[model samples]
Target: MTHASCEPARITEPDLIAIRDDLASREPIFHRPEWGSTRADFERMIAEGFWETGASGRRYSRAFVLDELERRYASPPLDDDWESCDFHCQRLAADIYLLTYSLRQGARETRRSTIWQRAGSDWKIVFHQGTIVQDA
Candidate 1:
């Protein structure tokens, strides 16, 4: 009988931090809803290899991110002002971290958290979870 070899797992906390930094760096670029403002930015993100999953459990690569951004831009405005954003590494182990970010814009604010693991030296994102919180 033939069997398939298992792929080794290589995830870490420092990796998660790097990914967070990379994503956070893009906030300013993504905040711009105009296609002209974001097209090249989104393309660059894809070239750099950022990826995420959708509610349907389908893997969304950097190309998908750009496509979705375009789709959103085609629709009515969906709030694009962020007064501030904060990130905290709640839990860390080797190359994994439970990260939380609180974002605020004018009178509205929300907090989002995610579990990130390193994929390699590049630090690919693994998971994300978010929630809204009342302003303190």
Candidate 2:
């Protein structure tokens, strides 16, 4: 299916802007050092039952993902250069949003989706997944 089909709905204009603003900067999750890259920070931002399907199609549990992230960041490597675009936000329920975007890291391109729940002004990720975008 084309990337366009992935974006199924559009939120209201105002919420669209606010959600895009609130979420865009925090995405490609765990990559934004400005938002705190520590394990504790990661823990705080993730829901208790957080799970993810990696671009490789394997599901990862909350503890596994968190531990791996902590290990990877313990001695942070050179900053990764990635770009994300084709953003779309759909309101799933009150204060819950599904954000979809495409991410490029060097030669690898992937479609990403994150389910986030808003808690006042802060947000926590409930679920996330990524699928590799095949070359034409």
Among these predictions, the greatest lDDT belongs to: 2
**Per-residue alpha-carbon lDDT of candidate 2 for residues 26-47, written as tens digits (9 for 90 to 100):** 9988888888778899998999
Compute the lDDT of residue 26 as modeled in candidate 2.
Answer: 91
Please, what are the lDDT tens digits per residue for candidate 1 over residues 12-128?
356356556655553433564432445564564333445654334466666667777777767665766675466555446776655566667666566655555554653334454
Worst 10-residue lDDT window for candidate 2 reads 7-16
Q: List ranges where model 2 is wrong by over 4 Å.
A: 1-14
- Candidate 1 has an lDDT of 0.53
lDDT, each prediction:
0.53, 0.87
Task: Quote the positional error of residue 89 for candidate 1 in Å.
Answer: 1.1
Index of the highest-TM-score prediction: 2
For each candidate, give its TM-score against the true structure. 0.44, 0.88
As a TM-score, model 1 comes out at: 0.44
